[model samples]
Target: MSKIKITQVRSTIKRSKRQKATITALGLGKINRSKEVTATPQILGMVEKVKHLVRVEEL
Candidate 1:
């Protein structure tokens, strides 16, 4: 399996609760925070949900 690097490039403050939850689920809370997570369906869904707030790259 491949891995992906997901970076929270934007702030989640003032955003909706769902968005904040998604950020937390992705192990990202502050701007510039990043986490290397496996590429799974659940994670992919979360990434798609907050695609605007993050940057993703394959590793």
Candidate 2:
């Protein structure tokens, strides 16, 4: 599978709990932190849920 990079770009303060949890599940909790993961449908769905809070890059 192709790999993609997920980076947290915004703060989670005052955000919904579901958004926060999705960020955590993506292995990010701090601004500028990044995680490289496989481009699986599940991961893509999680990214979609928190797209406003993260930056995704193809790798």
Candidate 3:
């Protein structure tokens, strides 16, 4: 599997509950926080849902 860095780049205030939950699921609850995770389809889907709130980089 490949790894990717997920970094929270924006505030979650005023966003939908689903979006907030997705961010948490990706190990991000605070702006500027980051987590390195495998690039699975499930993770990719979650990232897509909150694309506007995070920054992704290949590792």
Candidate 4:
């Protein structure tokens, strides 16, 4: 599987509960925090939900 880097670029404060949960599931809850994960459907869906809050790079 291809690897994709997920980085949290913004704060989660005042965001919806679901958004925060998605960030946490991605192992990123802080600014500049990043995780390289496989590009599975579930993971990609989660990323899409928080696309504004994160930056993604293919590896």
User: 1-59, model 3: which lDDT tens digit per residue?
Assistant: 99999999999999999999999899999999999999999999999999999999999
For model 1 the TM-score comes to 0.95
Q: The CA-based lDDT of model 4 is what?
A: 0.97
Tell me each candidate's TM-score: 0.95, 0.98, 0.98, 0.98
Question: In lDDT terms, how accurate is model 3?
Answer: 0.97
What TM-score would you give candidate 4 relative to the actual structure? 0.98
Which residue segments of model 4 deviate by more than 4 Å? none
Model 2 TM-score? Answer: 0.98
lDDT on C-alpha atoms for all candidate structures:
0.95, 0.98, 0.97, 0.97
Global Cα lDDT for candidate 2: 0.98
Runs of candidate 3 with Cα error greater than 4 angstroms are none
True-vs-predicted CA distance for residue 34, candidate 2, Å: 0.4
* Model 1 alpha-carbon drift over 4 Å, by segment: none
Query: Model 2, 1-59: lDDT tens per residue?
Result: 99999999999999999999999999999999999999999999999999999999999
Residue 4 accuracy (lDDT) in model 4: 99
